[model samples]
Target: MESLIKKLSKSHKDCPECPSPKVVHSFFESILGLLFPDFATELLKEEDQISEKIEELRHKLSRILIRNKHLHDGDGAEIAHLFFLKLENVYDLLIQDVQAMYDGDPAAKSLTEIIRCYPGFYAVAAYRIAHLLHSLGVNLIPRMITEYAHSKTGVDIHPAAKIGERFCIDHGTGVVIGETTEIGNCVKIYQGVTLGALSIEKADADKKRHPTIEDYVVIYAGATILGGDTIIGHHSIIGGNVWLTKSVPAKSKIYYQAKMYNPASDETDTYIIKSEG
Candidate 1:
């Protein structure tokens, strides 16, 4: 083992700390097993088997990061290992998403269905994992994970966002939840939605760039709510494709103008009209 470590150290001249990730991950798993004795058996039934799986996953992640230029020579593997050590949080996040899936929809037949079928769960799970890495201060890997999920699920959640529990997203395609955004519990968003910044210009850097969404708000498909200081009040329902830049009262329902196509002629145009209700 010593000779093998020396060989690897020589081979990875730029990253001397590569081997630390495995050790760090192992320590983390062991500590978790120690803390939760009730679930220890299930968590570590075949210790060798689970360790092998973790090592396999770590290698895959490391290779991907290295190949993609996400991991660098000077980047300490210990930093990443520390992040992986908090795997329990990842499990907790999964439970939250699964429970939300089971309770949020009657159509969800089983936990297996929630795990297998829901794109929302997938996105949220990715986000939770990414958020953990982000919190641990591993720069590129978290973004890479979330970006991978974005590509697969069409839900683009920035890893830097602070998300609370019981969050459920439905049909979550084309969703852009921005960095610096904070989402409270029981928030639901649909496809083609953007909870993003009002400005990306240099003047807006220190300012509020994205909206703060309170609890129980449902942002329907195709809505674009922007600005950092903008708050969508608790229990508000934002209509689809609506462009919002200001705060709304709790329980407020904002309806957006719908587009009508003229099939008669080649010329195309659109208009916006407020609702009477």
Candidate 2:
């Protein structure tokens, strides 16, 4: 007991205290509620009340950043101010994402439903918020925020991944978007999709390790695209269970052909590619 206590004491002293999970979650929920009323408990009756709420959230963020100043380079208060200034653009992008999800999914009856119930919206919302903090040079908190969403939604999107506007993730369970993955506009990915890397070498950590999906690409459920150099061109349809590690040109359709499902069969399947006329 003495040895264990002595060992933990030094490491505990060395490690700086970070913002508590409750505090971080509160900040996220407060900001989200302010943006979308579907998530808010009560609506602000006046413009002044709304303005006060914004300032309060800003102060909350300032405190969070100030608490973990060791993770990033800059003043926490200044970063908080700048983050709010550019937050309107993020809100606009989120609106576009919600619209895209509604238009893409036939089952979706209204925008309110998607905003209130969809796991994709929750995951994407976390990602966008984290991405903005990441851009402001804040590090650990962004990751913490995304991981919280991942825990709830089963969608693992890294804080650093570059995702374009109007992105839609339908039935988003078991979806993994890696750190270096780059996705373009109007791209839709279904459940069990893994946009991953071929290698896990620590030496290649600084290099690009994930594939790029171009505009208007639809990646269906259970598709796995890997390797840094692999690029799926615009207007491509990647079928369910299709795995690709090489670049495909624009307007291509890729799918795997299997005669029948056999749990007992240990057979290898090949994917067929078709280019649009």
For residue 55, what is the lDDT in candidate 1? 66
* lDDT (Cα, tens digit) per residue for candidate 2, span 7-48: 999878777677778878878888789889888878987999
Output the worst ten-in-a-row residue range by lDDT, candidate 2: 268-277
Residue pairs with clashing backbones, model 2: none
lDDT of 2 at 260: 50
TM-score of 2: 0.93
In model 1, what lDDT does residue 182 have? 89
State in Å the error of residue 36, model 1: 18
